[model samples]
Target: MDDSLIIYVVASMVTVMAISCWRRRCQKSLAPVPSGYGKVFKSHLFGKPTIVSTDPEVSKFILQSVSEDFVPFFPGSLTELVGKSSILVINGSLQRRVHGLIGSFFKSPILKAHITADMQRDLQEIMASWRDDQIVYIQEEAKYMVFQIMVKTLIGLGPGEHLQFLRHQYQKFVAGIISIPVKIPGTRFYRSLQAKKRMMKLVKYIIQEKKKNNTGCISRDIIDAFLNDGSGQLTDDLILDNVIDLMIPAEDSVPVLITLAIKYLSDCPLVLQKLKEENTKLKHKSLEGEDLQWMDYMSLSFTQNVISETLRMGNIIPAVMRKAIKDVEVKDHFIPEGWCVLPYFRSVHLDKEIYDDAYKFNPWRWKDKDTAASSFTPFGGGQRLCPGIDLSRLIASIFLHHLVTGFTWVAEEDHMVNFPTVRMQRNMPIKVKRKNIDILLS
Candidate 1:
């Protein structure tokens, strides 16, 4: 080989090797891509092939399915924990019936009034225990208050041994919601199942007692609502499982929503001031010894905007899962039959293209925005949508009303933890002091 010929041969060899190496690197990088690309993609989630969608239109389609194309589904551990017979697991006509029975009662004006009163009383009691300059953990406090109110609303229990026992067992039950599916002895799943059993026994006893004491009265609470159902279709198991379902949010999403709102308000002073100003007007209107009605709280436009923005940024529920009963194609993304489909609300909520300055905590953005749009799914969307949406909003609004109106607080250093669940790193500590408005309320 001459010098020129050798140089050409060596350069060609080197170029080929570099190309091969680059090909291998690209293949390696693409190997474990969960979901392919774009707003809709495919992945294996919790051991099942899943179609993950961040597109609002596809999400709306999946959530609004009335046919067999999609059905409510959860991970194995969650399905087992909540039980196969849970309202969450059941589908079609039966699920609708149960949902309607509970949802109708939950949405009735009578229940709303009662819920507002219960929330106010519980919040006031919780806030009363806070002293000036005290560093209160807002997460824990909100959880305590929300749980008590939920207990009262569900089974009409109020601050006693029964309530205490249920709360203790509930902690154990909730611990396994996202754990491995194994139910062996000493496992979190096993303990949670046992907790559910204990909770069921107590709840059964309470139901019987409530039934026995009934004097043909109107429904006073959810227990009464269940008992008064003329359909005769609501069995003991149905009621027990569904009541447990309701408690999940009471301990998780609802409190977390309130906590996140507080965190956001703590970070956004101008937004907090506007919320306080709006709520303070309602506060003054209630100063004549009148309890604020359900409408009074919901009618607070700015407060609702703050709640909307908080939910937009918080993404408490984040994503919801469904099982495809049939192979479906959404916007060129194909979901195989029986595959899990997750509509990731968090993505859409935080997508900059969808919302200008999406990362910023700007409540004013919601002032003229369309909250009913497909992009927002804080409490979820469609038929299986959270029945407690109104109730949760009512609770948060009432809490903010009282907190911002009667007191001032400086939040301790904390940041949001999004994965595994949305929660505060330090449970959102705040040093609070009573404001001048407290005296007027007193």
Candidate 2:
């Protein structure tokens, strides 16, 4: 054979070897959801992305107790994509302390102040176009508005224009975490990386400025407080990542969740009108920091139930994924030392064993307070059970309180909405009846 033939053969062999190794790594050890994820494949060698852990107790062992065994949540693909700045990747004793300091920022007053103003104002701005009876892309709108909410409340209301510009990049930065590592031209990873770089540059610059100026306002938002206070407990990198990470879904949670609730109420119009009536008595004077400090003030029976019900039905993430760190047993199955497991939250959310008319949307299910806690945990559960749970609830409630009590929101899309298709699939295109708005506080 000629020398050219030999070189070509050698090159082909190396390419094949690389491909084989990549496949083996992904199959033997799960990687991550690719960036710009189109559709997930359920199985390793099969058609769709299959749910690995079918049983709940199996999920519990991995997600909860077996933390000692697993590597926390470091997937090579996502880590390279997100880098190490994210708190979601930060594990061990140090993470515990960051959680503590960050926890302080979510005070009752701070949250209440956020809900009444920041959350409400942003939503109104996004929906103001609806006053013209314009057809708005709610899914995309939710994505944008929520991104802003996350930015302002989690960071600080500094520069709106810069925030949104940076936020657009930040969201891209976030989406990059799940992207394929192909950094060629027009690749998701390339775009994502560029976005992350843009964000980091901006955040680092701002942190330096604030430090130089001596704002002494680190306690203003979760990011500031985490980096500055509590015995210098958290690192600056962790603070920046957490700032961006936690800001995600600021509006998505409420809007997608509210959209879900609207669907439920659509099928049961009586419930819709009933909720409006209950909120009729509420003053639109706005919830303040003081009011939020006391959780019970806004914990109206009807309001809480509606928000809680939305959470139950809208367990957004299907299952929390975790791998076993050591030998663990669950429901007669030993989820060996290295196997991954997925705790399908949808199953728990609709488990016939736990709920009545499991498929039905019943806000009253949560009216009884303690009875509702067991049936719902849209955020999550246990030690890592969303520290921002209270604030999330407060935000959702305030939004819903404003929504149902104020203008009429109708589906601009088809009759029954889609679900399981993708993120917030069930959400319908809704238009606001702004002229018919009811000013409750007057």
Candidate 3:
């Protein structure tokens, strides 16, 4: 072939490839809906037409309506990574059975006891490592702390090289859960797939070990609870998938909330003062060296408000996806069967009509409002309401209680970005100082 002809051919191919890539990028872009499109607007996600809603009433209909018209619909990357048997991806009878087997475990008093002990010890250890004037990334440290609590309390796995390894792999897995679904070398999806395999192996080993030592009676830990139930309702694969699903979200969402709480408290000193006062008074009420009880956490009205406000602003779960099982009309918007429906909780959380000064960090706004209302759904709603809601709150509250009462911190940088999940751009670095005895005694 002539050299000129070859060069022309290469140029043409390059141009074609460039256009293809640009179109792919545009296909993934989700620009804000223009005004006059109503509360619900149609958009395309990965080439499929989807309905996106920012209305709380529409969100309620999609999440709670009992017509069997909609079911959970995760992205392709998540569906592949979480596995078919995962409770997050499955629906109908299996979901109920899986929920039945594990739901009680999450709500059990024994489980709460385990989490309390684990969280206190872990938080103390983490805080002890911080020194006055030292800079620490709260998001990174919070992830480590939350992951440790979940592993130890849920799977009965103690701190070790194995636990650390799983945490590392799980982090990578989560990073890839929402990436583009290509499996080519060096792609996030490919790495996530590898991480998923490693995590599954670790979880399977833990499950087998528990089964070997089972006494056929329910135990405080989730693994033993499933094994001892002996109903055989959950196969090993199902158990492993659900465990991964639960751990991935627990590791990310709670830590994001914790880190955001730190940011908000630092940004709003008056709110911090109120939070500190509430927590400090509780600390004074405790008998010397006595650990806090679950009731103690429950009574933290201001601290709980801080968490609610952080959840609202943080928007850890920006949206929940569901696919219509049949043709459904929500608020006069037609949604065809098989089309994706996204109830954007973040939109509702930030809606000016729903929240005053919606962008500002204000815990006081929650004082007079019902925090459990549908407008706030960081834990989601309906039958899929997070089984770990109470536990998540407990974890955040314990961490906040210890943090506000035990230390003083100033945010070095406070900027957050939310795409796959809400996270700090700088991982929320902060300078730390231990409170003096006089401050604690006061």
Candidate 4:
């Protein structure tokens, strides 16, 4: 046999052997884990991304105790898009300072003062557009209303025709955010860039005009804080980046949480009724500034329960991703340095051992009958948990307070809502039965 032929044959066998080993490894991953606990098993189909660690102790360590050793595992596309300085991409003290800034903006009195009027206005506009007793796509409507809320508060877009035009472009800009790399024609990335440019142009022009005139126009909110110091530490460029950071995600999360709340709340008529009564009480109070705080004591039990239950059942940020800072061990499994970590929230939220009736949709589970805020955490847990939890809670409270008070909900036939925990949502629709103010009182 010739030497070259022998070498080729040897190489071919090595390739075949390697392929065999890979196939065997894939098959092993498909096998199930120890029975009757969480499905803390592995499968390579979705890149073997399932959480093999559902233990709360383990979760506590990763989510709370040891955040120093991990940083976010942003989607490769997002990493390329958001860069590394924005709050979502950084680590250590820089993360703290930046998040502190975000936290300051989201603080209770500030956000309530900022968004209450806009929130009420946006809700009214959304409701007015709906035909009486219509079964619209709540998901789409919710998305639109949230977008309006984001704009009305983040900018000073008041009720007018111009507000609508600006909102459309803002929507276009947000839609482009998930676009990354290969910015060619017909691509999401290229389209997003165009959207970004248009948005900055419009917003910058507004800011510049305000600066030029010294219109004595303070936003009285975030956009206000950002604008008052116009071109200081909060430069136009930084404000625009912050716009992307806050508005895009803010726009998306509201609709999602609202949709989930509707799906969950529609089923429990008593819960709905309680909310309605609570809401009815609001009609007597002013809908602005400090008056919104009246919601603090109204149906406190039921409100808290509904919010908690919705969060638990829904999977918004299903599996949070973090890059391991160093080698870590759980049991016998060794995840080496640079490997990604996903503290899968869904698995933990529904773990049979943790939640008694893991599949049952129950809000009473979260009622603080005594004191401690139980095992319920939809806003995430630990040091790096979502900074917007308070603001999100406030937004949710604003929407739900009105929803429970202002309207009633029923399932739409054939277009019924369903839950599947794989992704962060359950695509569902409900027929909102608008309430007459008289009947809710008695």
lDDT of each: 0.83, 0.58, 0.80, 0.59
User: Each prediction's TM-score against the native?
Assistant: 0.89, 0.77, 0.89, 0.76
Q: Best candidate per lDDT, number?
A: 1
lDDT of 3 by residue, 15-68 (tens): 465345434543443333222345666655544567777878888888885438
User: Which portions of model 3 show Cα errors greater than 4 Å?
Assistant: 1-37
Q: For residue 276, give model 3's deviation from the true position in Å.
A: 0.3
Better of 1 and 3 by lDDT: 1
Q: Is candidate 2 or candidate 4 better by lDDT?
A: 4
Error of 3 at 413 (Å): 2.0
| Model 2 per-residue lDDT tens digits across residues 1-442 | 4323433564456446534643444445333323121111123211112225433454554455624765444345466665575656666666666666656666547556755576566666655656645554555665565556656666665547797778678667655554446676566667877887788777777777667765665466565665567576556777677776676556345556655666566567777777877666553324322232234436567767776776677666555555556765544444456555555566667877777887787888765546324334466555455667666666656556656665676665444332221244534666666644335543
Where's the lowest-lDDT run of ten residues in candidate 2? Answer: 38-47
lDDT of 1 by residue, 1-442 (tens): 3323433464456446534533444233222332334566555566676666778999999999874889887877799889776888888888888788778877889888888887888788778888999999999888888899888888888898889899999999998787666667777778899999999999989889988998757877777887887688778788889888789988989889999999999988898888877887788888867779989999999989889999999999989989988877666566778888889898899999999999999988987899889999887888888888888888888888989987899998999987567999899999999887666465
Candidate 2 yields a Cα-based lDDT of: 0.58
